[model samples]
Structures are given as C-alpha cells and as structure tokens.
Target: MSVTFNDFNLQTDLLEGIKSMGYKQATPIQAQAIPHILESKDLIACAQTGTGKTAAFLVPTLSRIAEGRFDFTSTLILVPTRELAKQIDDQVEGLSYFTGATSIAIYGGNNAQNWDQQKHALTSGADIIVATPGRLIAHMQMGYVKLDQLKYLILDEADKMLDMGFMDDLMKIINQLPKERQTLLFSATMPPKIREFARKILQQPEEISLSISKPAANIDQQIYLVYDQQKLKLLQHILKDVEVQTMILFTSRKSAVNEIVRALQKMGFEADGISSDRTQDERESILQRFRNKQLQVLVATDVMSRGIDVDNISHVLNFDVPQDAEDYVHRIGRTARAGTKGMAITFVNERDQERLVKIEKLIERELPKITLPEAIGESPVYDPAGNRAKFSRDKGGSGGGRGGNRSGGPRREGGSGSGDRNRSSKSRGERPAHVTAGAPATEQAPRVAGAPSTATGEAQKKKKRRKKPFKPKNAEGAGNSTPPAPAPAAE
Candidate 1:
C-alpha cells in the first residue's frame, strides 16, 4: 500500500518541508513506524540500510515537538559513529528547518569548547540531541546536558554500538534518562544479544523487519576470485573501465585502508583513506574531498562506512572482506542509493572464502562471479616478508605502510628492453637501424621475438612529438563536440 506524509497526523510545517523536499510517498519503514511514532509509542524497527529509516522516526518526532505537544529533552538519538551522529542531526535539521524545533549533534573528536557553545545554545533546550554513547555519557557525568525529561529515546545502529564495546557507556546513559520514556530501537540486523538488549529497553514494542536475504534489490553484486598476490592487480583492471566513477573501497582494518590507498595512488588514481586512527580534521578533509568529487576513491574501514552518505557513489569494492556479515551490507550500502543502480565488487582470496560464505549466507544469495583478464594474475610485490604481508611494494617501506613513499619507486630494470632509462631514452628521440623499411627487415640485429626495437622506440618518440599540448576548451565548444546534449539541470 502506498502512503504519503498526509496519511500521518504531522504538523503543517513538517508536511510542507516534506513536500518541498519532493517526498510524496512514505518508504516501507516510514509507512509502518511513523503513525506509531506520532502516537508516542515505543517501537523497534529492523530495516536494512538505504531504507529511509532515519526519516522514519525523525519526521514524526519532529512533528510531535513542533506541534507544542511534547516538552523537555523529548528525543535522544544514539548512534555508533560521529559520522552517523552528524548525519542524523543534518536529517532532523533539514526536516525541521521551517519549524522552530532545534536539534544538536554531540560526538567525540571535536573541541569541548564547541560543544559547550552548542550546549549553551540549547539552554532553552533542543527538541533532539543526536550523539554517540561516549560523548553523551560524558555530558551526563559533567552535568553539561540533562535527560531527566527525555521522552523519546532512539538507539540507531544499536548492534554496531554493542560491537564497538559501547554497551557499558550506553547503559550508563540509559540509566540516567527517565525510565518512562518511549524507546525506538532500529538496526539493520539483530543478533541474539541485540535482541535481548532490545527486550530489556523496549516495552512490547512494535517490530518492523524487512527481508535481509539479498543486497538492496537495486544493487548489482559480483565477486571476483583472486589470489592474495593478485588482488591489487584485479582491482586495477576492474577500475580501468570508465564506468566506475565515485567508489568506496572497504578494508577490514585501518592498516588495510592505508595499503589500498597506496595501491590506487601507484596506479595513478586519485584516492584517499579514512580510518579510526585518522585525526578528526584529517577524516573530515578526506570526506569533504570525496563528497565534492575531488577524490574518485575512498578507502575506508568498517567504522568509517557508517557515516558516509554521499549519493553519487557508483561502486563499492570489498578490497578486504569484512569480518562481520552485517558490515558487508553496510559497506555496499554506500552505493546504489536513492533508487539508482550501482555495482558492488568483492575481491575474495583463499583466506576470505569462509567469511565470503558467511556473508552470502547472511544475505541469502550467492554473489555472481566476475571473470578477469589474464594479466591480472601478475603477483603484487608487497614489502616485508611475513605470513601476513603487512604492506604492499607500491606503498614502499615499513610500519604497516602508513603514508610511506607514495611514488611507487622505480620498476626493476631487466628483461632485455624493459628499463625505465631505456623507456625514457626511447621517449625522447633515438632510433636503431632495425626498421628502415626498404632494407631487409631481417637484417636488424635479431631483436628478442616480441621485444620493441630501437626503431619502435623512435616511432614512440615521433608520436609524442606529434601530440598536441593540452589546452582547456571553451565549455560551449566542448558541449558541441559531444553527440548528445548535456543533461538538464537538477531540481
């Protein structure tokens, strides 16, 4: 059944904002949970990422407060990552822009002075406070914030918080809040522990579960069987096609993110890495570049995946398979957003077979296997010889390869005609006597069967000389050069 914002009793201001945002129909989660939320009832919504669950509660919660029917710190949303906290805050703020209700986000890794200023602004009190468990607990302990009157409590990505060992802190914060408050728990997947935790917090809450048996139906999923040594080569081959534009490449660890970023850079690709170890400013800079399309690829760990909400992502690559099945879902959720078709390619090696099977079982579908070019078999030269190669040759020397020599060093000069110096000399201008066409071609010093002779090198030089200097063409002329006209402006 199709439903719209009007189906729920929302404030005029919120309905207007929804209409302005061009959302006419409610997503499944929204349709099911909005009415109950509007009624101020406890609810547990289990829906996959990209299902619009954030809006499911934000709309109704904001609407209730906007109507002047709810009072005190009426809503508290706890997310696992700073990125997610900010994302939820943005969503609530956007929906309540015209409404007088205010929302603030609180998370670690930022100046306490900034948070102090935000808290003072909320002196009259914000309608909602979106925060991570640790920061919220800190505020509660310091008396910087209060939840005594908190009426609506939400645990977004509850399972993730638990996985991160935030349970004690979450319990501490929950204990401080009023026991009579309505609770809304939402997770993409609910493990047994999360279920038990939910049971303790929610009072006979309404349950909404969407099928998690497949990747988002709109996503095109494929896996490539690769040897550990050839993973980087396969990734390079896959990325060579122009079809992949914006991408999020997931790694299992912070170190893996650095490794992948180095590999991509060595291949002359613009990319960056984000992990828990990165300073807040560094992560923000990388994310901003990615959002602005200045960076084509973002290599990130599972922790960084939660907060990435960019809609232009066209591909998600599992460079290193995730340990948790649910994480695989979240990693791929970065792409195929807003009803657009996207692709997710996973590079699986022998060690990853078990984890890949677990992921397939969790998603209840087999990922289609993609064939690769024969050249992809070339082994990657990794730095440090150990059971688990900690770094790749492209990343250069030591310490897990974190920001090492990014130039990829020099290719070994061997194999007859394959030295960098030889290639450079050939690029400038030099010709051997081999290819004077009129002379018997065989008269040439017997060059290696398939090797390039000095004559071929001279041809390369001439080709380079004939190449035109790159100049920026006028937009009008460039537009005319394409067969199809440019797309119409976005609404």
Candidate 2:
C-alpha cells in the first residue's frame, strides 16, 4: 500500500508545503527512504529515474531540519552536475516553502559576479547547500564554507558522480563533514561500485533497492532499423505523420546535435540544441524554453540525459544509439514521467547493431523493431552476430541533403570547434578513432629532449612555405630555396 505525506507525521507546516506541491501519495522510493532518513540513520537508496527519489531525501531531511534548527547550513546535497544542483535547489525551495529552509546552488563556469554570489552564500550561510563536487571543492579550497554542524549529508546521483571521477572530491568533502551527521546515498542504478563506495562512507546504512537496470513500465519503447543516411528523412516523415507536442532527440555525438536541430528546424519545427559546449547560462535558457513548451523539439547529447527534470515530454527520439546500455535507460526515461505514458523510439544503424544487441540483453527483452519506410531506402540488416559484412558502409543514401553533407567526412565547418573533431573517440567506453590505421605505429619517433612537436614544427614549416609562394625547389628568379611540405593536420 502506498503512503501519503500525512502518514509520515511530519511537521504541520512542512506537510503544508508538501501538499502545496500537489504530491498526495508517496512513491515507493519515498516511502522506503523517508522513514529511515527521519530516524537519523545512514541510508543507501537505489531507484530508477523519475521515481521521486529527490523528494524521498529532501522531504525527510527538511522535516528534520524544521524540528528546531539554527542557521548553520544543516543539509548538504552534493550532485554531479550544475544543472542537477540547480534542480535540487529549486525543489528544496518549493518543498521548504512553509518550513523556511533556504538554499543556494553553487556551481562553476563563471569567474566574476557568479563567484561573488557563491562567496556570499558560503560565508553568510543558508539552511541547505546544493552544489556540484568540483565547484564545491573550489569554494572549500578557499576555506569559507564550513559544515561541522551539518545535520545531514546527501549524495544524489552518486553513481554519475563516481563515473565522472569525483571519488577524490567526494572523500575530501566527506572528511570535513561532521562524523556524527546522517548520510544518505541515492542513485538510479545500484551498481556494485556504488555499494563498495557506500561501504566507505556510510555507517551500517539501511538499504533500499528498487528496479535498477530497467526503464519505467509506462514507457512504450520502439525501435527502427535504419541506415545512417535515412535517419533525418524518416524523422521528418514521422513528425509529419503524428502530432508531437514536444520531443527530446538524443544523439551520441555533440557534433550531430546542431545538425539534427538544423534539419528539424528546416522541416518547420521549432528546434534547438544543448550540449556540453554550450555555456551554462545558454543551456539554462534553452531548458527553460523547452520546459515552457515554447520549443517543439530539443536536440541534445548524453549530457542532458540525467540532468533534465522536465515532465510531460511527449516523446524521446534517439538519433543515434547510446554506447552505454544504462544510458539508454536514462535517455528514454526523460519521458513517461510520474506515471504518464509516453513513447520512446530508437534509430539503429549498421555500425551500432552491436550496441543494440547489448541494450536488449541489459533490458532482458528484445525491443519491437519497426520496418523502415520504403521511400527512405532499404535499412541495413539487423544481424548482430552473423552479419559483419552484410551491410556496406556507404549504402545509406546519396549523402546529399539539406540535413547535412554525409558524402565526405564530418562537415568541416573550419575552425578549432569540438564539432570538427572526432567526438566518438572521446565518449566514454569507446576507443579513440585514431587506431593503428590512422597513425602507423612504425613511424612513431622516439621522444627526446628538445624534440619539435608535430603541430609546432608544422606551423614553422607553413611560415617558411608561405614566405615565397611563387617559388619551387631551386627555381630561378623566384627564391633561394623551397619550403617543406605542409603537415596532414595543418592541411
């Protein structure tokens, strides 16, 4: 049986705040975690996305703080991303409206006025602090934000922070926290790494594990076996076929974000994109628009997968398959939130068939694959095990469209932008694109002191070559000598 906020016997004013948010019933995670946190016991919680885990920790912690607390920053909520920090801070403000639990979100990315605000929040103190690990560490290094009197320490999205390699920062922050404080650890997936890490910081914590590796049942998942070039065309056809109020299109490559947004916009949809490359302020503005239903579609990379907290998302379209099977869950979890049904569609190309197979195995069921539209051309065969050479790399389409130029390599927009580089190489769990084929191991020179770097030497040779463009080697009446050839990257 599900419980309501009234059953928690929370403070009257605190219960008023919870009721004001229209949260009548407690989610399973909330039911399981709230009581333990109220009892001041260390807890480790595992729940899927969109399951009210944030409220699970926040409500009980706030109730405790409201039971009679001074102004010493009683609660510390540590998250992995600045967006999530801001999200929790917003929720804290809402849930603590009647109880008067003040909060400030501290994150990095600006140096001037932003720093001053963070410094003020740190020095003046608030009832709660929500911060990203790195930014909190930066403030902590300045020796102003103290937590000796903190009553509760919460690690939200603990797994993501660990995956982001914040173990050292987490430990450093934990070391400074009061040894007698209540600690709560919550994560979407309860991987073994999380349990191991929990053992280090949590003291005999009560364990609450819900469905961890699977997406919510409210999501109607579907798959499409598509050739790479057919993705945009099929996307356009589907949008024209259905009435999509709002959709989030996820791509593995940040470089593809802008192109997908551009293509969709050209098709007469109000579209925009957000990636790690965008400034935090820009991303916040775009997300605010998206949440307000001003944009019909939002193109993004995995950076927004777990960070986004918007609800009523009509659909989630995967422009490209995610490399991580777990990421597939979070990407699709953006929709079908809070018991509302939503659709999730994925595009699987020849190169990502192996990843698709792994996703099915992780989810413990094969997704229903839809046939490709005939007008878009034939899709590659979906034979992950026996079809290594079944599909040709160059068989998607004419590689020409307003969507993007697919005939050549990634559209070299000309500059040092990250979009111009091979993003697939830098994504987690994938090997760099510069394999032995791209760089011959036999040609690697030994590293010695004063050795000229490739880019620097290339720059010097380019200057020498440009000094006399009209001259050739030993040419008469042009120049005394010829310049060396340009390097490959310089070209």
Candidate 3:
C-alpha cells in the first residue's frame, strides 16, 4: 500500500500547501521521516541530497507549528553553507505559504540593513529560522537573538557542516537551544564521526537510511589521462566541440580557478571564477550571474561543491583530480540533478593517477577513458596500480627521438648527416661509433633491444617542462584558503 501526504495526518492547511507545490506521493524518506517527526520523535536520517529529505522534515514541522502549539521560534535548522541556508529558507516559504508561517534565512552576505532585518526577525521570532552555524553564532554572540521557545532543532546536511569545520560552532548553537526540543539530524552519509556526533545529540532517535552515497544514475562520467601541460589545450579543444550551454569547472586550487577563467576568456568563452577569498557579496553576485546565464562557465574550488543547486548545469569538468574520493561524488553531484542527464569529465595527470584509482574504487566502476584530440599530442596511459608499462610512441607522430631533431621529427636545422646515421643506429640497438663507456655525460647512448632509451632512462636530458604555478595577485586571493574566521559584524 503506497502512502501519500494525506496518510500522514497533516493539518489541512499544510496539506493544501503540499498540493500547491504539486507533491502528491511522499518519497520513501518523507513517508518514513514525516510520521516519526510528527509524533515528536527525534530522528537520525541517512539520505542523499536529492532524496527529498528537506520536505520530509520541513512539512511535518510546519504542520506542528500550524496546530497553534506554543511557539516563538518553533524550529531551527542549521546548514553548512550560506547558499544552503537560503535554499532551505526558500523552500520553507513555498511550503508555508498557505499556512501563514513566517521564516528567515540567516547568513553572512549582507550589509548593515540586512543585519538589522535579521536582528528584528530574531527578536520578534519567526516560525522557523534556517541558518549557517557560523553566521548564527555571530548573531547569538550579540545576546539579542532568542531561541528559548525553540521546540524543533534540525541539522540538515550534518556531515557537510562537520566537513566545513563547524563542530565548535554547531556545539555552541546546540548549547544555546533548549534541551527539551525535538532534534532531527539528516546526513547524506554515515561516517564514524557523524555517528559519534549523532550519538551525542540525538536521544533514542529513530534511524532511517535510504540508498547509499553515489552519484545519480543519470550522470555520464568520462575520464581523460593527459600530461599536465596538455590539460589546458585539451580543455580548449573539448570546449570548442562539446555542447556547453551552462557548465561548472572544478579545480583543486583557487589559483587554478582564476587561471582557467582567464584562459577561457581569452579563448572567447564566457567564464568567471569563485573562491573563498571573494567577499560574501561578490560570491553571491557571481552565482546570480551564473544562474541568469550571464556567465556560461563557472570555475570554482571545493567551496562551491556542496551548496550550489543550479538545475541547468549541462556539464561538470574537473580540471584536476580531487584528493578525496568522496569529493569527486559531490563535485559531479552539482550536475545531473532532478533526474536530468548531465556529463562529468575528469582530467587525470600522471601524478594524479593514484587519486583516479581511488575514485574508481569508491564509485565501484572504472570510468570510460576518453581519447585526447590529435592536436594535444601523446597522453599518459591509465595505470591504476602504478605498475603499467609505458608504451613507445610511434615515430610517425610529432616530436623528436633525441639530439638529431629538436622537434622530434626527421629533420633538424643545422645537424650533420652523422646525427641521422646515429638515430638509425640508436633505433637498431647498436652503440653509436663515437660513444664509449667513459664518454662525456652529454654523449648519447643507444637503446639495447627492448631496454629503456635515454628518453625513458635516468640519463634522459630533455624533460617536458612544467608550467609555472599560478599565484593570486594579492594576499586576499591566495589558493582556496577558508574565508577569514567568522566574526561578529557591526550593525
């Protein structure tokens, strides 16, 4: 027997709100969580981002508030990022429209007037307050914000908050709230740390876990193994050929984000960069432009990995492999949302091969390898175990073998015929005529049958030059450093 919102025994006004939002059947998380929450039971739910957990908790809480129960700020929801706080707050408004319950989103992106508005809402309570722990702690320190009448405390994306280093802030916020309140904890995954935190916060709570953590089935994942120097050129080649209506490119460093954005712009693509160094207002503006289609590509760091919820992201490109496997899931999760199919492309360099293997293990499948365009030259082979033998490049392709030709081709500008004869002898595994055991270090040696050549040997002189690392113009724009520690703002 399938259950609907009506089976949950929600208030008529709340049911009407649900209908207005076009939700007829409850998702598994909603059906299981709503009832337990309405019965005033604390819950610890393990569900992924798109599993409808937000409505599962919000609908029941709003219904309880509509019953005219004792209320000042009836519910408090703590989230990890400012963007998530606003997202949940927007959902709260939509669901509570028919019930006349008011709510506010508290985060750090605004000026004095915004602070005053939040102060007013806190003083004269709203039915629900959705906030980021760091921002809320800033307000609470002023001693004017009130949560004494709080009845429900919800921690949405609890694991994400911990990942963002909000444990101290979360504990401070919890201590300020009344102990008798109902506590609902929702996380996408159940790591050991999350379990320990839940044990401390939730008391005899009902636990419900949905499908395990994995990228949605609709995402089309692709992997490319290319040398670091070839990455930018390959990206440009792909961008020229692929359908990139609106996409996000994730890099491991903020400096890379800036560099990619600049390079993309030079290639005549509309793109912008976002990092922690940007003030809250600047970040919001960049996001707004992205949402409005004013920006075609957004290059960002892991800071935007979790909270961003743009629905039309046609693709996600990982310019550098993330160090953690779980972060790979979150980065690609930004796309292929709401059951829409999307593409995720990852660039793996020789140094990052091990990280790629970890991602493959986590996702439980080897991603399909993509062949680089011919213009990009030879690429590294995928070696998950770090033991795969390197292949010899075909001489017909571009680039020289050794000193005979600088460009790796048959012809050299000023080389004598001896260089050409030496090349042939080297290929044949016979020592060059002028070479001897005690020859100068620069003297060339021939490859013996299947033995490694100078190019592959320790005596190899010419190596692929690595590009200079990108540096931010100023101290504030350093490589993905967390925004300065949170502090109270002046009203």
Q: Candidate 2: misplaced stretches above 4 Å? A: 213-220, 336-341, 386-491
lDDT of 3 by residue, 11-118 (tens): 898888899999998889998999899999999999877668899999999999999755578889988766678779888888988899999998754255566778
Looking at candidate 1, the ten consecutive residues that score lowest on lDDT are: 424-433
Every model's TM-score: 0.72, 0.77, 0.73
Query: How would the candidate models be sorted by TM-score, starting from the highest?
Result: 2, 3, 1
Would you list the C-alpha lDDT of every candidate in the order shown? 0.69, 0.74, 0.72
Task: Name the weakest run of 10 consecutive residues (lDDT summed) in model 3.
Answer: 424-433
Could you tell me how far off, in angstroms, the CA of residue 38 lies in candidate 1 after the best superposition?
A: 1.6
Quick one: best TM-score, which candidate? 2
In model 2, state the lDDT of residue 216.
76
lDDT of 2 by residue, 104-124 (tens): 998755334666787788899
- Candidate 3, overall lDDT? 0.72
Q: Which stretches of candidate 3 lie over 4 Å from their true place?
A: 69-71, 213-218, 227-229, 333-341, 377-491
Candidate 2 contains a number of clashing pairs equal to 0
Please, what are the lDDT tens digits per residue for candidate 1 over residues 1-491? 79988988889998887887778999998999998887778898888777889999899888878887565678899987777887898788778877877888876643445555555655667779987776565445445576788888999988777765567667778887898988999988878988899988888788888866456688988877666556667787777774768888876445456777888998787999987667566878899999999998888765667778787789988876665677788778777777889998887654455667779788888777666577875322322133123333323354232221133322111101111222211100011112233322221222333423424454455555664434468645653453433323211
